[model samples]
Target: MPKPAIFWDPAGLELDSLGSNSYLRSTDGDTPYVSLSIRMLSVDTPETHYPGRSKPARSDEKLAELASWIQEGAAPIDDGLAAHLQPKLETGRAGTLHGEQGEAAHEHFERLVEEKLTKPSGRKRRVYLKSGNEPFDRYGRLLAYMAPNYTRAERDEMTPLESASFNLLMVASGWAASFIIFPSLPKHSDLCLFQEEGRKAVEDGLGAWSDPLTLTGYEFRMCVKLHTVTKELMQGKKLSKAERLRWIDRYCCDMSTRGVYSPQDYYRVPAYDRIFIWKKDVNEAVARLNLSPEV
Candidate 1:
């Protein structure tokens, strides 16, 4: 629990959201400075907007299929929460809001920020970026635990195991999923804190946790990738209902240890296990080709 050195540039970065987790940040708040897309680290919220206008992510039919799989698998949702989640689950099913709970998480975070801005006391704020062991993600976004206007000095009195991470706050508040990209980063405190918070949220049936589905960002990515890879193998052939599940079983077993990327790939979760939590949509897509369940 030794303190990692804080990475901070003296000049403030002007941070504004392009969407839920992505931000457009500049070196200076007023005068122009080098700007880049800052995606919050270790936090993945349900996306509320489309990727068409921003830095492009891999968006295609396969991704759409992945989204639908996540939602469809979460069917027969709680009646009390279904109303708010329907829009997020069904909106632009081809691209945005693919999860069962939809954009509720996105809206929740936005509303929280907006409320902070309109506070009558006019609280002063600063963005604190705590660089993790790995500073850049595959997408070229800086991987740092970001806190808007909160600082280390505020938490100096706390013990080594304590965390004041806004990123952790998101999970603690049930607004984001705990996305651990690098497990060996000596980030035990924050990692443990987020896991505890995430578990509690799930136990309380909050946000994405409400569906009783919990996955790291890397796990989610692997689920989508696994589906795409399986589809490619089938090459549009329709499989019988029984064959569909069997195919998934075979694919997962074969790819369990096969490296999806390279030596540094962080998706350690096996495909076979992820199948139970991540395969509904892919199953339906294959089922559609056959038309008849028995076929």
Candidate 2:
């Protein structure tokens, strides 16, 4: 019998673009680029491809206030454990935010990927993509909590987001937002961890949080063109009758009469590229319409 395919591999790795968050992989020893886009799970960075406009400067007082918020928002722990774990929890504090700081983050990520995964200098390093439950995002991107530190057993034991996740690092360093699109998904555990990191970033006044003009995650997502479908879904707005019907046909959308179902019950809807509706939002839509599940 053949051995199980290992999750981490260092073979045939090539990074295409750091700005768009894409890379190439060939674990099967085939040609790379077979996987076009590999998204860092649970976070979204500002557009390095298009740096739109200047953001306002954040006040020093504001930064201090934000940092304090992070320390307070940390999850509750036993007093005995809290004192000991406090230093470890602070590990995430020493990070750099992506777009907020400069285009440096894109270059930083590229360099990190090269050093950790592609470097053939000594013993080649292995990178792992932990596809916690929901393997693909609605955009068809391979949604994964990436671990360049997979070789470290202690890091592997930590939750992917809590460990050395390229995704969470972006958020922790203030490079990205804790963009929790599908809150009800199995990756919620990872999301929670990323959220904590994001709070730390905010508290530390890292990245976009330091920019007065930079929007909060909710505000930014609502305004971004990439998140149109998500904004519409969350705001209880409909594009058209036909569009609604199509969504129903594709994603089992019974928005007219909120239906209750597990988030796991739904799969990727083929019709839409990056459309996603939270299970609770769908249920609320269903109840709002007072329509039966059949609708």
Candidate 3:
């Protein structure tokens, strides 16, 4: 499936002239007319396109087994995570649950954007965007954290957490998972806040967390990717060194270890310890973090 799209914008010359300062024309230097996608920073909502019949297909059944194995690998990070996913995996309904939660997250997210960006008079306001440490992701999408375009004085009225970026709010509200990656990890103060919010959300069983089977967006995508290879491995097929290395590069990163690992070793890294890094960004991530992958 194509990558999901959200928080994308196409800024016109008029808005740029009005000082929105979106500089949406980054992708089109000569024309100054095109828009680009924005991959919101530090949060990931559920997968919206995973097909589901609420009953396991042969493929779904296979994926379920593979997912369970991956969950076991992640058990060291948080035993509760694998425990939480167990019921749905056993019933072969993991994919269906993911799709359902994805829909719920989408609807809630839409309402949130409307509530945050609409003036009481019903006119819409532009969202506030702060670019990430890196300007763009490997997908060419701008990476940003968005919030209401409140003035500094207006924002001062609210507590910092209340005024926090929608990215953090999404995690606080439990509709999305905290997904901060290396180099984009915020300063200590803000990082503490995000962690607190995430802990609270999980404790409160809010949104998708209310459903024990819900997979974070990253986990959902990983299951989709690794299932096929996992199936081959299960059948006793051996990968050549190049293939093994390629799959490992594409497959493993752990949050707890803050290290990249081979798929066989990836499960040892623990859940929530996994971080997202695109293939092209691996070199940069390695350089920035001084990582040594488990080859």
Local accuracy of candidate 3 as per-residue lDDT tens digits, 43-114? 898776653433223335755676577566721223543454455566676766777777888898889888
lDDT of 2 by residue, 1-295 (tens): 9988877776543444333554566566665544446777656665443213533122222223333333564322224323332332233321112234446456667766666564345666667776745565555666677766444665656666545667767777776666544422325355455556766877777866675344433222222321233335446775664442222221233222334333222222111111235544655545543534431
lDDT of 2: 0.45
Candidate 2 — worst ten consecutive residues by lDDT sum?
266-275
**TM-score per model over all chains:** 0.49, 0.45, 0.68
The Cα error of candidate 2 at residue 181, in Å, is 2.4
Q: State each model's CA lDDT, in order.
A: 0.45, 0.45, 0.66
**Which candidate gets the maximum TM-score versus the true structure?**
3
Ranking by TM-score: 3, 1, 2
Off by over 4 Å in 3: 1-31, 50-59, 65-88, 234-237, 241-295
TM-score, model 1 to reference: 0.49
Best by lDDT: 3
TM-score-best of 1 and 2: 1
The lDDT-based order of candidates, best leading, equals 3, 2, 1
Instruction: Report the lDDT of model 2 for residue 108.
Output: 60
